[model samples]
Target: MGKRGGSSTKGWAQEPIGALRVGTVGPIADFDPDSTPGFDGDRRLGEELLTERGEVLAGLQELLFANGRAGDHRSVLLVLQGMDTAGKGGIVRHVGGLLDPQGLSVKGFGKPSPEELSHDFLWRIRKALPPAGRIGIFDRSHYEDVLPVRVHSLVPQSEWEARYDIINRFEHELVDTGTTIVKCALVVSKDEQKTRLAERLDRPDKYWKYNPGDLDERAYWDDYREAYQAIFDRCDSDASPWYMIPANRKWFSRLAICELLIDALSGLDLHWPAAEFDVDAEKKRLAALPD
Candidate 1:
C-alpha cells in the first residue's frame, strides 16, 4: 500500500489504518480487493474485536449526540463508494449497528429524480448532509457525478471533467465547517462480484437484492476502474482523504469500517456534556417527589 499524507495509526493498537489510504498517484487496479490491509486477524478474531469495541464506539457516539444537544458543531461523515455487492450494506448493518440510530444518519443515493435533475449535481447531496454531533453515512455520494457520469458519458466531457475541482472545494468547505469526512472506496474483485451476484440469484431471500442492470454495469468494469482511479488521483486531499477498503471478505470490510469509525470519533476527544441545572438541587427536588 502507498501512503501520501499523515499516518492514521493514532489510537490504534493492532495496525495503522494509514496503510489503506490512497497515495497521491496510483492505479486502483493494483490493489487486491480480497487482501486485508492493516489487519492481521482472521474472521473469528475480527468478529471478537468488533464485539469488544462496541462499548467504546457506543459511548463515543452518545457523547457526540450529547455534545450536539449542547450546541457543538462538530460531526462526522462517512462516505462509502463502491461497485454493487461490495458490502456497503453490510457496513451499514453491522458496523453502523454499533452506534445509536438517533445519532446516525444513513442515506443511500441512487438515480436522481426528475426534480433533482433540474438543479445542480450537488443540490440533492447538500440536502442529505449530516448535522452537528451526528455520524452521517453516505451509501454513494457526490463522487457519482464524476464516476458514473464520466464513464457513461451522461454529461458532456468538459462538464463532468470540471467536477473534480468542484468536489474538492465542496469537501473542503464541509471540513471547514467542522465535519470530519471519512471517504472509503470499497474495492471488490470482478470475480467476487460475479459470484455474489450469482448467489443473490441462487437464494430466494436475496431476490430483491438482484438487479438486472447490475449486469449492464459489470460490462463496464474496466471503464469504472479507470474512473475510480481518476477519482483517487484527483479527489484525494489531506483534510478529507479517501480510504480504499478491501471488500471481498465481508467480515474484514465490516471490521475495518468499524475501526475507522472508532478512530474518527476518538479523534474528536468528546466528553459527557455538563448539566445546566445544579446536580444537588435536582437530586433534592427528585427526592421530594419520589413515590
Candidate 2:
C-alpha cells in the first residue's frame, strides 16, 4: 500500500506565523487545500503539518506558562470558520490537544438557542471569553452573526448588517486588554466537499452527520461566499483580521493555522514572576509542613 500521506519532513516545517496576513494570500497554488493528499480515511497530508503544528503549539504553551508564572498574563481568543467538512473540529481536536486542558477552552456555536437568541448577538460570545493567561477557541465564532444569519435571512438584514462594527469593536477591546485574536476561515471546493460527504454517507458511524438539509444549504453556496467576502471586507481590522485557509488538504490547513497562531504569540513579553519569600522563611515553612 502507498505510505499514509502527511509529510513529516523538516522542509515542510511551519513558516514564521507572522508571515501570514489578511488580504495577502501569496499564492492560491501554494496554499490551496487540494495540495494535501490523504490516504485511506485519513487526511494523511497532515503528517508534516501536524508535526509543525505540534511544535508551534508547544511554543504557545511555553509562552502562556511563562505569563502565568510572571503574573504578566496574556490571553488568546482563536476563532475558526469554514464551510462544512472544512476540518474545524479536527483542527480543534488536534491543535487544541497540544494545550494544557486547564489553560484551554473550546466552544462550538451552532444556531442561536432561545436564550441565546433572546440576547444581543455578542452576549453569548462574551460569556465564553477566556480569562487572563488562558486560550479560548470559538469553533464557528460570532462571525456567523454577519455571515449565515445574514445570508440565509435568518435575521433582519438591518440587524445583521450592523454587526460588522459591533464585531470590530468587540475584538479591538480584546486586543486592547492584552488578548490576541486569531481568526481563520477554512475554504474548500465543492468537489472536495462532495467526496467527503460520500465518505460520511458510506460510513455507518458517520451516518448521523449526513444531513439532507446540507444539500439545500449547498444551493446557497454563492450567498455564503458573498457573505464571507463581506465578513472579511468589514470586520478585518488591525486588531483582528480574517485568514482564509484553503482546506482541501487538512495538512496544509493545520500547519498554516499552527504557524499563524504560534507567530501571533511567539514574542510576547512573557516571563515568570520573581519569587518574594525569604529563603529562611520558605525553608522553615517547608520544614514545618511534613517531617
lDDT of 2 by residue, 1-291 (tens): 111212234434334233344456543233455643222223454575466557656656655765665675578888999888888987898778777888788999998899998999898999998777787889998888887788788877888888888888888888888888889888888889999889999999999978888778788888888888778778776678677777887766776677666656654544444566788989889999965
lDDT of 2: 0.73
lDDT of 1 by residue, 156-209 (tens): 999999999999999999999999899999999999999999999999999999
Given candidate 2, what's the lDDT at residue 218? 87
Q: lDDT of each prediction vs. the true structure?
A: 0.85, 0.73
| Candidate number of the best lDDT | 1
Using Cα atoms with residue i matched to residue i, what is each candidate's TM-score against the true structure?
0.93, 0.84
